[model samples]
Target: MKWLGVLLAVAVAVIVIYKVNYPSYSYRYRLQVSIAVDEKIYTGSSVIEVVWDCGPKIAGLGRCAPSLGGPATLIDLGAHGVIVATLRSGENISPTPDGAIDAVWLCASAFGYRSTNEELPALPHLTGRRNLSVSNLPRLVWFVNPADMKSAQKVTFLNVASVFDPTAHFTEAFVEITRDPIVVDIPNKLPWFSELRRLQKEGKGTLSKSGQFQLVYNMFVGENS
Candidate 1:
């Protein structure tokens, strides 16, 4: 009986240790986006899942941090009227003496037209040093009495910086982040997965010539130890 009790104690300890070292957590986002162009409003929604696990860490180097268990689920809003939506994910690494911080980000863009036959306007050239990075480009644009689809008329642009700017006074659009549980495998069954995979293969370096609206979402995850 004493030997049996000892065995039970050892089993419990091993389970606890495994749980601590291999912990997993995930966050799910349901994004709904609406864009108004001319007299029409276009809308779309997407579900994104991100999972992390507290993997092994080197001793005396840094704290134990979670690593992505697998590739994050991508977002594809599909075609809403003449507007087509696209999303892609990537990581940015910032190194430290002891470790490195990984910033995983998602970039969202949309292409729109008055009609399928109408040629979409070219994306405006980003001016000034602050606009150099693709991440810095505007997510939403408000056109005011455009002369034509191809005309480079004056328009309002909204990016991450401008959204937080006190003077920008952006009231029409907003981005939200929250902690919510999700089924990790749900994205695989989604109808848009094939198309989203194609976009992911294309990567962020290439911009769609037909793209007009762009937005970026960033989340900081594990540190390499």
Candidate 2:
């Protein structure tokens, strides 16, 4: 019995060692979107890349990645009359003609923030920060529940149309700032939050009942939306 117990302990230790030594590989990601506008469905994909300051290694991991340099089009609300779009990370089911990263990079390049490349490029100057000037409420944070591909999430953008300010400047003069996506929360604080609820109640605004979802709000003070 003593010998058997020792063998079991040894086996367990070996398993633990093997599991700990195994490394997790990270890959660049791509996003696909399926937009539902009334009866018409439109689709596109975009390659999303994070510029790591260093290669994948413990010494390099401490380096920070840049945020998006400016407001880029994630989707064209006007061109396709996009109402609601389903976004997933891949190219299998939908095409990726309309990509957020592409738009951001292009605009960033035009402003001379970073030079563009044919393949996976890095925007070294872009850094992520919460812009309090845009909204007092923090942006939405999310992760999957049950960790299954089948689970889907629904989010609404309050005053999605009004978030963007037309006249905004992008420069390397100050640190290039890229805004994160916002999600709505309770105890409505911003004036826009009240306006959104009032419009929803009054049956006004571009967003309609058919398009209603639990709203998510992220406001970049100068983003194009």
Compared with the true structure, what per-residue lDDT tens digits does model 2 show for residues 195-215? Answer: 544555566642312222233
Tens-place lDDT per residue, model 1, 108-175, is 12212111111211212111111112232222222121221122111223442233222332223222
Residue 35 displacement in candidate 1 (angstroms) = 0.2
Task: Evaluate all candidate structures by whole-model CA lDDT and list the values in order.
Answer: 0.30, 0.29
**Stretches of candidate 1 exceeding 4 Å from the true structure:** 1-12, 60-103, 106-225
Tell me the spans in candidate 2 whose CA falls farther than 4 Å from its real position: 1-27, 54-63, 66-73, 77-225
lDDT of 1 at 191: 34
RMSD of 2: 16.7
Evaluated against the true structure, the overall lDDT of model 1 is 0.30
